[model samples]
Target: MINSDEILKKLAIESNIRQEEIPDIDLYMDQVIQLFDSKFMKSLRNEEEKVLTKTMINNYAKGKLFIPIKNKKYSKEHIMLISMIYQLKGALSINDIKAILAPVNERIEKENFDLESFYSTLIELQQKNINNITDQIKIQEHEIEMLENDDQLKQILFISALSNMSNAFRKAAEILVDDLLENNKKKGDK
Candidate 1:
């Protein structure tokens, strides 16, 4: 039997996947390939073209489609799986692909083949991402509030000063007009 490391190295070279990208290559070789080559992966691609790029591989890994083998690195199974996903990207969303790969990843990660328990963790992870997004929104809202309040204060102060200047100008113009009218009347009478 070919060793797991050899399989992973081969997969890396063939699929353009980096060795470092396959997180846990040493411990579980069979499960790694199995997760990658699941029925979902196969259905996603055409049989003739089967290699994937580093981006696809990383997406799959992060999406929970494939668990990194613990110790061994490369294998034909991993290559075939990536090939399948590459084929699928044409029609599938990253989230859709992740959903399809979820069960397979769960099984591999557990090493025991049970899937029921892993769903809980997946939900938790999703919730955590949501919380993080919400927190960022809250911080942005607070910053906007501060900026808006400061702008309003500045506008109020500016308007008050402008109004006072306008009133003074109006009073001065009225007094000047009255003085000119009185002098004209006196000259007419004389």
Candidate 2:
């Protein structure tokens, strides 16, 4: 049997970038790329995978996902926002991410929002979800073990359960993004 404890440990390690790890001063583009590469090295599927590139950063700027850069350097807040974009890109379109982050970006521009504190709260919530997911995995494994001696069926069922859960969460996120966009439109119209 696979080691569930090891999987849980790996998940916890690979899934987070603590707020303190971010550099306090601004970084050049290359430095930003290097930071993400080092932090997310284990999460990469292959050695050749690039975590962040100059083009991607430029494109994100063009998309207005965050405030404009200053003097060819990225601030700590910019790095945090880019990290969020990296996480969301796998499951959401760029438009969807833009829609979701629009209000936050506005606050950062107009109100000097404390992104560090907001990111800390997000990390706490993520840790809670990780614990919940690990518990769910254990339950699923126990149920799989109780089934009849059909290895193929067990594997299929386990994968299906995970896929279903992913689909549900992705759909929920899409729905929320749509609602946010609608509300923003209504406010603009008023």
Candidate 3:
């Protein structure tokens, strides 16, 4: 049976793509796809798992879900945005992800903020409590260990908690993004 720890260990520090990991300059669509594909492969998942695809990247740009590309090349901002969408897509709807990134995209367009700073800060924040997260996971592992006979109950509880956590993050992100969007609009009106 597949265990969370095994899946998570494959993720390790490689899961979060550091700003230094990707090219600082713009990249072609295929380059973007290749990067994502290589990352997915590390989890030992099938190639057909479809983490990111050409059509999806095109669709994201068409939908303006992130900062659009320039001269057919995706900037660092684009990479960060795409990376985030890939991470969040599993837990949130496309529209929800769009809303979450809206403010950042606007700031990028206005030259008010660069994605390098934002992405770096975000990565740092996520890593700050990495140990705590691992501890929590170990606790969950112990709890599941104790309830081995009640596998169904454990699955239900774990999924419930996961869903709640996803919702909490989504709601908090929505508030910040919405506020940022509003402030930008108000500035434009002035």
Candidate 4:
């Protein structure tokens, strides 16, 4: 059986695409897809597990999760927005993303926000939290190891725990996101 620790180790080594790696110039649709896909290739489970796709991009725009495109190209800000949407969409709904990004998007469109700076700051904070993330994973691995007496049942119990934990995590995020949206709306009403 493949240990959960091994899996976590592999995930830790897989780095996400950094802001500096993103091209400064606006890119065509295909180029954008290729850039993300190639950069995230090592992290992908398989070729069929796409990092990004033209269809998904189009759907994001149609769903209003993405801001307006400039002419026929996607700017760096657009790239960052799309990237954020892509990650969020894995564990969140389109409505949730729309709610979360609405205020930030407004500031960007109003020329009061700088996407690059925002992205850099977010990256910095995320990096700061990496140790905590790794620590949590290690804690989980330790818990999994403690189940060694369960023999073949250990993996099943670990996976079930993961499922329950994911549901709990999602529920918490949904509630907090809804609360934030409500607070923002109340503030806007004033």
Pick the lDDT winner.
2
Q: Which sequence of candidate numbers ranks them by lDDT, best first?
A: 2, 4, 3, 1
- RMSD of candidates 1 onward, in order: 32.1, 1.9, 3.3, 2.0
Deviation in angstroms for 122 in model 1?
25
Candidate 2 structure, TM-score to reference: 0.90
Candidate 3, run of 10 with poorest lDDT: 6-15
The candidate that achieves the highest TM-score relative to the unseen native structure: 2
Candidate 4: C-alpha RMSD after superposition: 2.0
By TM-score, highest first, what's the ranking?
2, 4, 3, 1
Stronger candidate by lDDT (2 vs 3)? 2
What TM-score does each of the candidates earn? 0.29, 0.90, 0.76, 0.88
* Model 1 misplacement above 4 A: 1-51, 111-190
Worst 10 residues of 4 by lDDT: 8-17
lDDT of 4 by residue, 110-138 (tens): 87788788888877776776676567666
Candidate 2 Cα outliers beyond 4 Å, as residue runs: 1-3, 6-14
C-alpha lDDT values of all predictions? 0.48, 0.83, 0.76, 0.79
Give one digit per residue, the lDDT tens place, for model 3 in 1-190: 3356874686553467778988877889999888877766565456567878899999999989997677999877788899888877866678778877876787888867868887888888778757666666667766766866677777776666656765887778667666866886898899
Scored against the true structure, residue 28 in model 4 reaches a CA lDDT of 97
